[model samples]
Target: MLLQIKRLSSSYGRVRALNGVELNIEEGELVALVGANGAGKSTLMRAISGVQPTNGGGIWFDGADITKVSASKRVRLGISQVPEGRQVFSEMTVEDNLLLGAFTRPRLEIDEDIEKNYVLFPVLKERREQLAGTLSGGEQQMLAIGRALMARPKLMLLDEPSMGLSPLLVDQTFQTIQKLAESGMTIFLVEQNAYVALSIATRGYVMEGGRTVLEGTGQELLDDERVKKAYLGV
Candidate 1:
């Protein structure tokens, strides 16, 4: 497995957010995690990325235990997270924001990486000198994904890529995600839109009340009666 979580639990002070969550992602696999708002999906993503503190259980990446790893170190170890919100550096130019993602890399290789981002997100190249804050929501989302790719991560954690997008932009964003997965990037996606998320997933898990309540191939979850009733609006 490229990533593994065993009984992982996290908390926000007195409130428990994750309850023994277990999941795995294999190399080059596109795994989707779907749940409703407040279902602890984002917390689980944070825990896996080593930003949120864990009270119990473990996280293993590429066969190494990294539950105690710092967030920066996790990034260096090839785990990159594109958080729930776009969270772009509003004051910085588009090129500068992309440069920041490669902070851990050698300076000599940074420019090459930046060019790669431009190729992947041509709009960012066009707006290289523009401040990130001025871009439309969809453009910012593209920039966010481009920034994360600059890290050259082995596993990409995407939280709510479709949040706040127009229906047309949502469709475009997911098309990009599907292409990324098809090109062999391993991804762990957390999303509230069950239908969109599951439709592109190789496999999927359902989170409920701070726990993973179901796991199956994408089609399996889509075809499941309970999933249909509760999430698919069948």
Candidate 2:
């Protein structure tokens, strides 16, 4: 497995946000976890990425136990997360924001990786010198994905990539995500839009009330009557 979590648990002060969740992703596969707000989807992402502390269980990446790794060190281990908000550096130029993603990489390899991002998001290339704050919401979301890619991660985590977008932009973003998956990127996506998310997923797990309630291939979940009524709005 490229990433694995077994019986993982986490908390926000006294309130438990995660409860013994188990998930896994193999190399070059796009796996998705779908749920509504406060379903612990983001918490699970944070725990795997090492931002949220794990109170129990284990996280292993590339066959090594990383349950106790520091957040900064986890980045070096090839996990990059594009958080829910398009948290671009509003004060910095687009290219500058992207450059930050490769901070741990050798200086010589930085430009080459950045050029790759430009190809992935041409709008960002055109706005390379523009302050990120000036871009529209959809543009900022693109920049955020580009910045995360600049790291050249082995595994990428996308949290609610389509949130708050117009239907058209959301469609465009998921298309880009599909392109990435087609290119063999290992992605773990957490999304509220179950129908769209599962449509792009190789496999999916349905999450509710801090635990995984169902798991299957994308098509299987989409075809399920329970899933349709609860999440797909059938």
Candidate 2, residue 92: the lDDT equals 96
Alpha-carbon TM-score of each model against the true structure: 0.98, 0.98
Compose the digit string of candidate 2's lDDT tens values, residues 23-110: 8899989999998889999999888878888788899999999999998898898999999888899999999999998877889999
Q: What shift in Å separates residue 28 of candidate 2 from its native position after superposition?
A: 1.2
**Which pairs clash in model 2?**
none
Q: Best-fitting candidate, measured by lDDT?
A: 1
lDDT tens per residue, model 1, 8-74: 8888998999998989899999999998889899999888888899999999999999999999999
After superposition of all CA atoms, the RMSD between model 1 and the true structure is 0.8
